[model samples]
Target: MSTVDNPWELTRAIAPRRYVNRMIAEADGVIRSNSYPSKYPVNGNPPTTPWAMDLTSLDGRFWFAAFDLDAKTPEAFEQASEDLGVLVRILRDTGLPHVVCRSSPTGGFHVWVPLAGIDKAVMVQLADAARAVLPTLDHGMLCNDRTGAVRPPGAPHARGGASTVMGGADDVDVLRTPTVTAGDLLRVTAAFRELRPTVDPADSSPTGPVDARHRAHRSLPAWGEAHMATVAGGRDPSRTGYLCLLAAAVSGWTLADVEHAAKTAPGMEHYRTRNRPTGGRERRTAAEAAARLERQWAKAQERAVLYRYAPEERAQRDLTELTGIVDVVDAMLLAFTASPGRWTRTEADLHDSTVLTYLAWLSLRTGSRDVAAALRSVAIATGIPSSTVDRSLRRLHEAGWISRRRQADGPNAAIWRLSGRFSTPGEHVGPLHDVTARPPAELFDVRAALLEVLEDRITAGRHDVFTRAGLGPTARRTYESLTTTENAVHTVAERAGLPRGRTRAALASLRRYALVVVSAAGWRRRRLDYRTQAAKKLGGKVHGALQRRELQYRDERDLWAWWQDHLIRKGGRRGRDRVPTTQAVLFRAEDERGGPEAYPLYPCSSDGRADHQAAMRFVRGGLLQDLRDLELAA
Candidate 1:
């Protein structure tokens, strides 16, 4: 074949230096390859063997925004070909340059649009816009940043035939010519936006007059109004406003309706003001505020498309009964606690168990196995930090104890569902002996009784003890287990669902405070008042340990604050230079002695040190209670 006609040359035009290859054989059914990219001479002839080109470069830039369409039979292939024609017409109408190729002998199609060094996220969005029109497009091809390789034109397919350009060498020139720029992609996205169906209030109810529509928007739910009025530290105002607008949009409110509600709502005064350049707030003109509301209203409409509720659905939601399944969930927790090997082997494992148990309880209390909760909400409910709760959720999902059904979006918490192991009746096999099969009683307030049971098992209701004693979940759980009965270290570890070493260490710590005692049989708790005994035991040698630690933490925080001020004063240092220096100062106290190890840092480099100091402050605040509790006990 000539240079323009050569399949390898055509492939090299789009991905010249980075391509993978595989041996062509019928037995090689899988798409496995250990091949790495290597440079090839641009002027050289095509390689003798078939090769595939990576869609994304090593530096995370996309060479082409591509789509694949496959069919299992000839009839399906014909149908797919018709859909391909429709897609081609759409692209042609939008003036997007593209290339089409027969990807395999079994009749899969690959459509490629050359991109000018576009990022993966933007490329995915462009593809999504196209997929909205053609739903049959295979999403896996560009589902993530690390998209797999595609067999280039002229490359041999393992199944039989070689990939061929659809219009032959005539259309191959587009791959090497001027490509689709970001501006072009944006224009196409805008065109696709026009194709999206307009929101219809008729789906909610009969089309109403302008005043009737305003009345509908004014009927905000209690939760929606609360979200709009909430103003708290660490909260994003933009996010709060967007969620409030989304709540209205999903309820079938128009843009005018949303703006009117924002202006008239009692607690929505913040929406009328804009920050000045001098760092002072000023009330915006009506036109300026309306423009801002319009932008937010558009975003809310796009996001709430999937969640929009009909009139009946919204009206009946409040009337639905909240039947509690505390009995069933309690049984599930009992079973999970008894089987330590299934969920627990380490301190982190115990945390995952605790989070999973709490999620089950929340799900049952809501009268469904599906629960919607934010990380902060879960943290508040379980007394675990938000960061730890996030990790526990990941672990629970990975271990098949729970699964996230939907991600959190505007005004909506993430929806999580208990797995079959907990949700399915008669599936929990443990010492509970089929307690989950029993009929649940209707309890008016299950929270108090449920909390007592959880505290007895996992110390879930002991935030005060956690703060006062500086005890983490694992240590608290071990202590709770010991309080029930005297038991060997191994037995206590089993009951607490912790590692033997951690259980032993907890025992030693408690013994140091005279809260526990060792005997020939096992370990037992002392009957004396724990706070008084602990105070008297630690009064002398360890009396000032907490104060010293607090001082040290405060000094470290001050050092970080000074560094930040120094950077601000200097004013010319880049972020790269500031982060390492700030981090060094923040962690300067760490050495051979025990210090905060594995301290969680914020992902943003600029705020990482500040966030670390905030965590330290929280720790020091917790220690204040320790001192006060000890003094009172003494």
Candidate 2:
């Protein structure tokens, strides 16, 4: 077969040195060999070792930008097949034909359009065009850097999987090597360049009016061509007719136009012959066959008007309004930090403040009380694990801070809305106005917020009780639950969302680490009450603070550290000195607008550490206690 006729064969002819099969060491000295690209072509001799992850680019070779659809597991592989169909549809709709290879049944695919040493500018433009169409593809494998490495198709994966060609094979019974002549590849990419702007760059949220009609016009031909291929490949006459008719209706094509397009669609005639060939004697002319197709198109037009081609309008909020939303969230978080009880019953329940901040930002950014985002998007933005986002979302939901609405129509995204309790009356969605009402202190995920605080302290050595204890998640949770008051083992277990056995095991581990004191001398003999022996033993006012709930200090030393970090201001004759008194510092900070007071509260205790109890009491009974009191004082 001509190299131009086979994608794999063409690739090999152009860059024969790119392919290599090399030994890879697995567990127990087990060795495997698979095809991987060398750093550069070696004139048919490959390197002895596999390519390293850091070796991202190569030189002196004709390269293509690759979309690597890879699944790490079998389930994902199956899902990838569906994703592949979406990608093919994207290509069809955009009217760009490119070669695609199923690198393995385990769900690995490489879709590529060769760059003919195209200048950097053209490549960049092509990359952007590719990105524009990428959203239509589910989980499309693309890299930010267009010049990155692409694995050759001839070799198996190092993990021991075979590669097979996909798309436009004549026989379903046998796998054929994929091929696209160099000239064809370039022609398709050039066509992509022309169609790139018909639809705006893949910005789902456009700030201004988009040329919807123009985009729709450009998309029609690709849609028809793609459906034509689908019909040919499926060899279903009815579907071919249905799709062709629907395309005509949607595109507003004349019956004559649709007939002409379908007849010349490369494989249309072949499919027509195989599915419904006209016999001899009464030999039907091409005109008669075209009429039959036109009839089908006319039938499909009846239902096509119902399909929507226009983009929906999205609500846009001014940048200042967006900033105001963030400020409100900050204020809410600051208030929560002052008193964890304002949100949760226990301080330890505040797991990661950063995640909470991310959630708040997302909600505000979307200009809605509710946010609908994929967990993957959250994880990427927050730089945390998707699992962590899942856990945090669950905690927030349980705490009554936000409610989740699972997507019913498409994609795996979930909708999250801030609690009505936290929202101001008649407040418009988005960040247009500040929520003036006193922020709610009675509900939220306190632990999620505190995790961010703990992370800071951990880095500063201001607190290490939890980390030093080396407790598992269950143990850590159990220990936190035991901090404020002793509870029955079952109660603690239920609160921590663990099984009885698991909770018991966690409590025992905490006990072993001296983090929790578990007592078994209760009425039922198996009944247990727990307390944080570690915090109570810290001595001085810190110990008293923990017992009386007068302060939210985690450690005795943390109080002084918190004071040094926040309360002390630097404006003395010497240019840097303590502000003298906590009351005075607070007054100065508040008086100077946009000072530390304007920032999120990082309150210190009387002796100088985090004291959520005192902070809450101070805010309630001290500063800004009531408008009536202010009037009386005035």
The most accurate candidate by TM-score is 1
- In terms of TM-score, how similar is model 1 to the real structure? 0.33
- Tell me the deviation in Å of residue 611 in model 1: 68
Overall local distance difference test of candidate 2: 0.41
What's the lDDT for candidate 1?
A: 0.54
User: Over the stretch 1-634, how does candidate 2's per-residue lDDT look in tens digits?
Assistant: 0012433343345442444324456676554433333343334444434332211124433344456655434323433443454445445544444566666545456665544443333343334444433222221223333334544444444545544555452221111222434444444444433322221112212111222222222245555545444423232233344554566667778866665655545324321432211111122366556555654554455334222211222254444443344445655555443444433343334344435555664554344555665554554443334566677778877877767765523323677765544434364677755543322210111221232222222221112223322332344444544422345777665444446676687677656545544444110111122122443454343333312321232222233332333444422211112222233332322223133323223455668567765545544443422322333334
RMSD of 1: 28.1
Model 1 stretches with alpha carbons more than 4 Å out = 1-4, 16-18, 23-45, 143-147, 168-170, 192-634
- For candidate 1, lDDT tens digit of each residue in 1-634? 1223566666656673454544432355453332434434435666544556777777877767667766444433533554465456456667888877777667667777777777765555555555543334565575345746677666776546777666522376777764788777767655544332222222221111112212334666644555455542002233345556766876678877777767754334336754221123467688767766775576466444323211111211321233224545665666655777665666677667767766765554345657776665555445555677799898878877778899976336788987656535435566875453311111322322453344344322233333333545566677767642346788787767667997899888777766676875477655332533354454443334433443554445434443444344346542111122112323323322113221222212465334455544544454423332333334
Query: Model 2 Cα RMSD, Å?
Result: 24.4
- Window of ten residues with lowest summed lDDT in model 1: 204-213
The clash count of every prediction, one per candidate, is: 0, 19
Give residue 434's lDDT in candidate 1 (0 to 100). 40
Off by over 4 Å in 2: 1-12, 16-40, 46-62, 117-141, 144-147, 169-314, 317-350, 354-634
